[model samples]
Target: MKKLFYLLSFLILTACGDDKFSPGIPDIGIPEVEQPKDVDSVPVVEVPEVPEVDIPDPVIPESEEPEPYRPTRKIGKTYTFDLVEDSGIDQTKAIQDVLDKAENGYIDKNGDTIVNVIQFPEGKYWTEGFDVGLKKKYVIGLLNKEFIDIEASGATLYTKAPGHPYGGDIGKGRYSHRRHFWIENSKFIEIQGLRIEGSNTIQGDLLGTTKAYTPDFWKAGGLDRGAHGDVPAYASYLEFEHGYAVNESQNITFDNCSVYGVWGDGFYLGNKVSEGGSRNIKILNSVVDFVGRQGFAASVADGVIIDNCEFKRVRRAPIDFEPYGATGYVNNVRLTNTYLEGFHGGIAALGRGQVNNIYIENVKINSPGPDISCWDSAGKTVRENWHVKNLSRVRSYGSHVGSIRFKKTNNITIENSFVPIAKSQSKKSMELTDCENVTITGNDFTNGLYIISENSSVTAKGNTPKQEIIIE
Candidate 1:
């Protein structure tokens, strides 16, 4: 046949081109994209252009304000002793230069020493006490108030010897003593129009009665009692702003000046050497003279405020709130616009036990004896709420007035006051006992009379009678 039909058609065209050029196994079905001859000539899918991100603009700044307290020298009449070199009167380098200038001081850390707020430049300051002692809050301060004058030869200003459990009651302590300018427990403390008496003469035991002028001024505060006293336990607050301790020295103060003869006790609030009894004390606008005894006495004190203060001569009770030794009693006390003169017993809030919330307002008391009094009782019995008021009294609590004199006192009030009687309208202005809601209001007593001391309950309003209002 044609050579086996062309060799079987070339082996059947090489087995159908080897099964149409298949290497593994193919049935072939991929090639059909020809439907776009005019689908807008199709070929548009180009979305590649992401570059538009830049944002930075928010700036804000400008503010300023702070400055005031300028002090650039203004202390006149200046003169210095060639900046000190005297070794003679050197009392331990003048009390170690006031205890290293009150403990390493200021003015840009002084190299030689001397703290000047200006005004010591009149000349004549010899110095001593370089040994250091008596300075705990003004061992000395006389910032010129008519010029510093202590020299009757400066009568031995501090000599130093004190040391021993001897805080005072005498015995066991004596450090010669010399305090020219020593400030302790400091706090803007100032002494204007200065005088400073007894300039640390070191004179103890003046003997007014000795256990330090008694009422036990509070011995046993710390209880050493060797010579008979120790006291070291009462210190909460002590302030004498606009000062004038003039003389006699014993923790004193005189505001708005004109203070007289300090032998101690013009205005003495306790603690420290008496063991405890100092509380928020305010003696406003002062003028207390010749303090013979108790011009203003705040006992075991809690809160004592004596406003618009002024007293004269002072024999005993210009104003007193007990508890130093009748046995100590203190709570809350207030005496406003006070003016008591030559006093024997003007305002006396006695103590054996009770004295809480005592308010004597718009007061103008003149006394020979018994203007206003509270007998703080607990002995025979009877202790209760006793509150008097706006008094211009004659005699109150004379017969031992007490809200608690019977161990069961109640609220008592004597308001809008003024009591000046004792032409003996038969005396006895106010005397209530075992009280209970006793209110004697709007009183212009003009004179005297009120003795309700035996199981009382009274309520009298607008106590009229231009001159007299008596009740027994």
Candidate 2:
């Protein structure tokens, strides 16, 4: 029984000795399962599936936004003179303001701002005068070049009287010897449909007399003493009151305008000999009446054209190409379809200055003096190339001698004209003195005589009445 008990203990010890049943050793073959510790543990969580959505961006305020860009230069603009602003008073300041604004244009998306067009309303505007264009240089390499158009249809610019105080000279109460419209050192200016009226009493018939010649009146207004002669007295009194005075300008045009009761010429184109002269000036469809001097006059100019114009009651000739300076000249002038009446002379191109290439076509003159006169002064003889065609209705008044006269000229041609006999005078239709290459043809000189003297060459043919040609 002791042997059986030992064997059983040995068997138990042997079973305990196996590594699979040991306390510190783990089983290698079979996996162990984990069991839950508590019943209140966290439940299983299932994530929900969300649908896709579109969201918009946030908006910004206008104050925080950026502006679009703009260019620097701009094109020419048109400005109209405010009738309300420039009314019932001296319109010099208001008119000048508009001119200045137009001259200095605004900038925008267009081209360079250089040209401007100014328009005025229909009314009577009293002014002292207006001066425009650059008179001196500003910067180096900068030219006084700008284009301006003045559209003054149905507008009248009335000048201050001789005794009235000039606007430029307020305290002095003197008449300034300034033009009504003075344009100098400019290019490409056009003035349209403007009427200019001045306050001069001397008309055609009252030239040499003391009709309105107030010597103390003019002297108190800062005018020089007039000369002794009748015409010179009145002429020197108000010599600078021209309707329009242009100096050293180019490509200027005056269209559909009228000048009445001006003290000086209707238009005066002059330039200093040191500077370049005026060029390409044109006056078309205009009228000049009751002026103290010539209708159109130039001292040193080229390419002047006067077409479809009428001049009446002028103190001097209707058109005068007489340059006053020694080195001055008038060249390349054309007068077409013009009428001259009630004047001292029709057209005169005589001075110490040189005159060349004048053409007159379809000109009708009814005056008391010579119809057309082309001559040189006593010592100097440089006038040449005068042509007159289709000149008719030439009626002289008060026993004036010759209807057409030429002296000391060269290359003259007078054709297709009509001249009536002087009834109470010498009955001379045409006269030539010291001329060269003169041609008189196709004219109606019935009961009229041709007096030729010291002419080098003359051709007279195709004339009516077959009058006798006298050569002296």
Candidate 3:
């Protein structure tokens, strides 16, 4: 009875709590799962730190001022000429006295030949003319206390009569050429910030016509002061190698000056008296107006540059490169960034010697007459290798005549220029006579480019009126 009772109880327990086995048998099924071990006695690992890099600060630079121009010659001394205006003082003589002292070299009390920089203060000083002799490396400068001005009552050097002595001759007996400031044989001459005036209202005599030795006074005709003539040559500035063979004017500069109302040329170079002509001359930032003859004339020049200049109201050509006497050459010349207005002609190069390597660029010309006229040399004169570029006329129409007239020139280039004229106003906008090896390209012309029947070896490409390029 006890065994049946225990079996019934076990069956009841298995059904209620442990159905998978008898009531007490589940406790010993797995025995004991393996126990996990402790990690307290294991070895340790450590990570190293990265080192830092050092950076430096940046550095800055400072600007410095430019040094003043120091002339090569020893001219540590400065001398001033204070002339009295309207004091009945001959300002010419007063200025000439100091110039003579400078040219002759002033000996100090200590027996040292001190070079000087002669300066003229502001005053309306009247002078017939004053001359700067040859072989002077001194600076004839105008003192600009406030600014550079053509002072109404400032240093105005005036000339008196036609044949009168305004200034002294430039050189000794043979090389004597007259100018207000005649400079010759100077290694480095600086003329800056000055104004010169002449009486154009006064009737002037011809330079070569007034010789007493010849009875024929008007034989030379009405040539400009620096005109080139063949028959009974009116060449009088400096006869061909007439004087002592001095060194040509070199390293000379004309800056910030004004020249007006002159019966003669405003500025003249190419001393025929010297074997070597003027070289390395620079004319910059200046104005020349109302001259009876050319604004600037060059007979024989080697290495000349006319830059940033304004020429107006000139009677003859603004620039004349003709060596009137045919003794020297004009080479390596450049006219750049210049303005020309109201002139008969812009540039007329009748140079006897080879007028070669001439470059004219960035020029603006407003003329009522011809702009450029290169005279026909016909083997009599030699001109080659000319480059005219980037030139524009401000006005719509140039003149009744052709804008560019090329004659007897060779190896020329005219490009990137604009000539505003029409075929109705005349057929030829540019005329070339006896010219060869010319290339007219990239130009805007109103009328066509015309060449004579004799012109061979001429190329007109990329020019307007491409169909009507060569007009015989």
- Candidates' lDDT values, in order? 0.44, 0.70, 0.60
What residue pairs are clashing in model 2? none
Q: Which segments of model 3 are wrong by more than 4 Å?
A: 1-75, 103-116, 129-154, 164-178, 202-247, 376-378, 396-401, 422-424, 448-453
Deviation from truth (RMSD, Å), model 1? 21.4
Which tens-of-lDDT digit does each residue in 416-449 have in candidate 3? 8876665456656677777788788888875544
Please identify model 1 stretches exceeding 4 Å from their true place: 1-265, 272-287, 290-294, 301-310, 313-317, 322-339, 342-345, 348-370, 375-419, 422-428, 435-447, 454-472
Comparing candidate 2 with candidate 3, which one achieves the higher TM-score?
Answer: 2
* Better by lDDT, candidate 2 or 1: 2
Best by TM-score: 2
Roughly what TM-score does model 2 have, to 2 decimal places?
0.69
Q: How close is every model to the real structure, measured as TM-score?
A: 0.26, 0.69, 0.64
Candidate 2 global lDDT: 0.70
The residue-level lDDT of candidate 1 at 213 comes to 26
